[model samples]
Target: MDEQSTRFETNAGVVAQIRQLPVGVVLASGPFNYPLNECYTTFIPALITGNTVIVRIPRNGAAPHFPTLELFKKHFPSGSISILSGSGREIMTPLMEDGRIDFLAFIGRSSSANALVKYHPAVHRLHTILQMDAKDCAIVLKDSDVEFAAAQCVTGAFSFNGQRCTALKMIWVHESIAPQFVQKVCEIVDAFKVGMPWEEGVQITPVCESGKPAELKDLLEDAIKHGAHILNAQGGRFSKSLASPTVIGPISQHAKLWTHEQFGPIMPITSFSDLSEPLDWLAQNHFGLQSAVFGYDPQELATVVDTMAFQVGRVNVNAPDKRGPDTLPFGGKKDSGMGVMNAKEAVREFTLETVIATTVNDPRNVKALQGLEGVSRVVKGTAGIKSE
Candidate 1:
């Protein structure tokens, strides 16, 4: 991914030539979140690397409008890229168990990921790429632009009803600016629009699935019980039932929302006297996807980058929930997922590396190799005594 080595490399008088050889047939399947664009993360890259792709479109609860499927059908050849449509387990299990499907790329819940790999261990030996849950952290420093940072946090936390894995679920503000920052966040929350997505350009839609709203509700209640103050829509700290685009004040360590990945517009803010406190807190969470830090000092920001270099997949500076260009490697660490799905990385993931070598130790000018093994021999005139 760093482009350090792609074509050839030589070290210690040994030349190692590499080629990208595609995996025979790949099965790319996932949920409807970013349904079209996310599928391309795996499908297109696999295709570009010469692997035939079979995409399984989500056909159940909250299944998105598959415009890409139609586009594929109209233009591409029948067998070049196949599209499968059906309910979840019934259709997926058979394809997963099939031996011919060499590579698997899945995006869904952690439990479903286990089902895909665990059940068909004997048959499905391929290492599956998974993109699952995350509750990302947003660190706001005292020197940072508080209002700008809060605006970015609001968009990141509430957009898509906060369903995105990169959404800012937890916000850690410097203790010096905690009061002002919380007040501003509540002001924006009050102005947030909540209704049907198609009506009046509503900002906060319902949770993608049926049960998720209730789950978010329960988590909010638990956070409140644990001493987190919920800021009502009018920018007042009045205890009430939680709903869409609700903002919560600084919570303790024991709050459920602090740990759980809430797939709805529930924003939780915390204050820290020292930066290391929140950084350590973030490290313990098994799900490491993406995080953001807001600060003006270049040295401090560089330190943050250095600390999070291997901690998360990507780090956003002042921008909130900003996914870079399609060419950028978009992925997560640990429980968040495995392997990046950008064009270059996906191509690498779907393709196998092959090595070709030669040895000058052989006395004979030409030697016989395995008849059936597919190794070839070619001759050429050389001026030097050894084939160096």
Candidate 2:
């Protein structure tokens, strides 16, 4: 935390503010995809800021409760933290409506975020932060090492069974080698192990079916029915412990799957005639959480870095999907989310600012007759007491 704050001061000017008053409460809500992380991200920072925290675990019960509680209890005072399991939004609403909670942070979807904004009490002192939905992309180039790109893209798209908001959902490939790239990527994906998390050799595990996988499959099926290609992961079997990671190819720019955040092991690939095609595709999308690029061209990398549509928490260059460190702020750009999470951003979100000014020297003790040196002397300059 100290190292992060030090970097923040050099980059974002956080140390000056923290040196000032820093006591507040932070209310954190956990997201189902990364339950343990979401809970820890908010809870630790709030506790560090000398503020109490109340965390609500997701309704589906996918939290690392004992480990998290144990870690906090070791360092924090009794009653400084409370992890309540069950009922996410229902439990959160009361805290948002209360002034006792100085800061409120949530990690979920856009719909849930809108609900909080609508239901929250109109108190100016209460600060709210959201790390919600995102539909991320993987831009594949023509000159890229086909096999390496496929492996990287597979890991990026299905490592957490595509449950991460930062996972690659849409893949944009250059039309010059789109067919070859698709074939190679599909072949790699087909061989990925999908089974129990504790299995000897498994790369992807099933998302606890709180209904997300079924909905995502329906979307993929709809895409296929309407002219897209579906490349089923060949070696995987669908069971309670494993999810069938499917790849939908040659997707259109306007497909619903391109715009929505599919929280499952499903990959959708679209071909672009030129670089602008993918950049334009990004411009129209609603969510921007993270993006990965598999290319050798420096120009393309520069273009993505400079584009407004590339706005996201982290940008992966030729690497698989992974948020770098707790030091970097993680969140989305568009309807994907607002505010930030983890590292310095989370700490800033948990605290409030207050400015104080004071005036000394009694009015009666002042010399009223002093000239311009000590006090103001009015001249009859038509504009009344216009002092020099």
Candidate 3:
């Protein structure tokens, strides 16, 4: 609702006003993981920028949104916000094919995003903001503190059962310190408390997606068959929806885990003889969301960081890869995703810049433009601007 306008006189004796305008109706869909937060990250920006939004409740976490229906009805005008439930294909296909959606804000897998985008009748006319798959990696250098690196890696890889898009899916440790780092990681994994989400000290909870445990088990077995060893004693233990954190080390490049975005509680580790091994792997990898490098030498870390910046969207020197703070740019590259999210970026993504120009000599045109500005200011005062 905040009206942004810039008025300036050009050398051509013309006065122009540049403003932001909504991109029309937006169809927003978020993944089951971080359902509420991710969904609002998309639709809230669109709504604030004057676009009507149609939100598709994710199949796994639909119940959490039921409580927000009353809030939406109270704040927005009728038909401004609509929530759709049921099978995604059944509801989304018609919306996309109808060619009414101007913006598509989706956070999920690449395959699902591709299918939904292809369903749109006029692809070129549709603007999309997609946050998809990521196989983020972490590299621990030989001179780094093994204990601290292991702790950071554990938190990054196993948080939310490794379902996060920014989670460290693969880890590369220098050959000299690989064994020590892997041992420390295994110890931390064993200490994690797995139980119901409501438990006071629970660190690992049941996965939301159905059959995810089985899928994770299959991935673990595949890595083992391809020459990786399960380092943790209780790793891969599964009962129904719960799967204990698993650590598989020295994973073969031929293993499925090497290329797959194992969005589960499975930590895959590998060792590198030289820095080139990890850097080359990153170059050849399809995903480019984020990467982490840990080392004591400033120059060594800087070299890796510079190389990783091109290969990924963000690089963490000694911390875990994360989306963070809500103010920073959150996005990926290549097969990982398209477009960016966060406060300012999301607003830009959901709106378009529009310019209105008039000849300075045209008295009538100037008067009309002034009147329109007055009306816009009045409207903004009455509705109050909303921002993220």
Best-performing candidate as measured by lDDT:
3
- Candidate 1 — worst ten consecutive residues by lDDT sum? 364-373
Kindly list the per-residue Cα lDDT of model 3 for residues 1-388, writing each as its tens digit.
2445444334466766566788999999988898789988879989998899999978888888989999989988999999997777898889999999999999888998899999998999999999889999999999999999999999999998899999999999999999899899999999999899999999899998778998898988899899989999889799999999999977898899998999998999999998999999899899899999999798889889999999898999899999878889999998888998998888888988776666656667656656665666422221221111
| Error in Å for residue 239 of model 3 | 1.7
State which candidate has the highest TM-score: 3
**Lowest-scoring 10 consecutive residues by lDDT in candidate 2?**
378-387
What TM-score does candidate 2 reach? 0.82
lDDT of 2 at 253: 48
Residue pairs with clashing backbones, model 3: none
Candidate 1 residue-wise lDDT, 292-381, digit = tens:
999889887887777766778988889886566868988889788888877567768887766644443442321321221244332111
For every model shown, the clashing-pair count is 0, 0, 0
Q: Per-residue CA lDDT of candidate 2, range 1-388, in tens?
A: 4332222111131112122234567678877767777767767777777687888887665445766668778887898888887776568777776657777677888898777766666656667777777788888888777778877887888877888877888888888877778788788888777667799888777788656656876687677766787766462234554558888876754566867777788888888878888777777778777787888888877887567335766777888657758777777788777787767777766665542211113332122212222332221111111122
The reply for model 2, stretches above 4 Å from the true place, is 1-19, 60-63, 67-75, 233-242, 308-310, 356-388
lDDT of 3: 0.87
- Evaluated at residue 310, the lDDT of candidate 3 is 95
Candidates 1 and 2: which is better by lDDT? 1
